[model samples]
Target: MEFTTALFYVFAAILILAATQVITARNPVHSALFLVLAFFTASGIWMLLKAEFLAIVLVLVYVGAVMVLFLFVVMMLDIDLDKLRAGFWSHFPLALTVGVVVVLEMSAVLWRGFLTVGRQIHGDSGNIGDTKNLGLVIFTHYQLAFEVAAAILLLAIVAAVALTLRRRKDSKYVDPAQAVKVQSKDRVRIVKMKAESDRVTLAATEKQGN
Candidate 1:
């Protein structure tokens, strides 16, 4: 077997194992860590496939950003493992069935290209060329789909923020508009004390005459 082929198989095996562990691990943090490992291995596989742009993006975006965020969130949550596992056995059968179906579908899709004969089809000729081509395709043919996906992701971020931001009636919060509209003239009062000065002068004169 070629060295590249052997390395490909190794990376693929690692990715599969890590993905399985991501779902099977009892600890949420461990599962998230395994998912990060899976992303790394997948990126390696993409690199081997000559999709350098996709590979780098997979590592930078998913492994570096998304998985780190997931790890922090998992660690922060006060999760009860026992409570989580309570219905595991009850859900196992259905989950297993779904998993099998998914595996079969993936196998069928991959098997479709099994007998195809070709040299290593490099999606990206080189580092710079690949990025330019990727950007061109993304902005041209796939622009609408990309925009829709971005919109969906934006909605998800907004929903997550809304869910985490709890309203407290006792807590004082400033309204930005009201604060911006406030003026110094509305806050300070300038009162004239002309009568007080005249009264003081009259009292002083009366005292002096006495």
Candidate 2:
């Protein structure tokens, strides 16, 4: 076979192995590391496919930003591995069935494309700097779709924030109207009470004792 085919197979193998490890690793940190490896291999495959922009974005956006955040969250959480694994066997049958169905679906989809050869992406020529034209095409033709996606992403962000900010018994909330009306005098009180001398108080206490 050709060198390109061999390279593809190597990257594909790495991706598959990493993905499997991501699912099967006992430690969440290990699983996250495996997922990063899988992303790397998938980016390599994208590079091989001449989707340079996509490969770079996958490495930068997913690996650099998203995966780092995910790893941080996983590492920060106090996960009880035993508790996590307790229901594994009970859930295994359904999980296995779903896994099998997914595998079959993926295999069916990929088997057809796996045999296909290369073509120009977005009708652009096989040039190195086609990303600019591709972006122009997307922004021009799919402007409405892009805006819709942005709106959906904004909605998701709002939803997540609302959920995370759910009021608990101990949660302190400030009234904006009260906050607006507050003044320095309202916040700070000047008490005008007479102070008793420590010497006089002591003398009074001694007299009382006598």
Candidate 3:
């Protein structure tokens, strides 16, 4: 076998193992860390496949930014591991059935030469191929789908921000609009007073009453 092919197999094995660990690990943080490893290995596989743009994006986007955020979230949340695992046994049969159905479907599709079509497409690429050509095809043919995906992602981001803005009784937050609208005239009071004569007249009236 070619050296690249051997390395591809190695990376694939590691990727699969890491992915399985991601789902099977009891600790949420550990699962996230394993997912990061899976991303790294998948990036390596993409590199071997000569998809440099995808490889770099996988490392930068998933491994660097997304995984870091996931790690922080997992650490900050108080997840009960035992509670999470409690229903595993009850859910196992349904999960296994779904898994088997998915596997069978994948096998039927792949066995009918779908996987070969992917290899054929990749094999037809020239030595000078780059992300520029990929971008052209995506923008020209799949522009609508691309835009829809972006819109979906934007909605997800807005939803996340809205959820984070939910009212919390224990939290103190400032209203920026209220702060900005305050004027100097509204903040200060100017008081003018007479000299000690006015004060002495007020004191003499009190003494006469006594």
Give each prediction's root-mean-square deviation over alpha carbons: 5.8, 5.2, 5.8
- Per-model clash counts, in order, read 0, 0, 0
Q: Which sequence of candidate numbers ranks them by TM-score, best first?
A: 2, 1, 3
Alpha-carbon lDDT, every model: 0.86, 0.88, 0.86
lDDT by residue for model 3 (41-101), tens: 9989888877888888989999899999999988998988888889999999999999999
Residue 24 displacement (Å), model 3? 3.9
TM-score of model number 1: 0.70
Which pairs in model 3 have colliding backbones? none
- Each candidate structure's TM-score, on Cα atoms with residue i matched to residue i, is 0.70, 0.71, 0.70
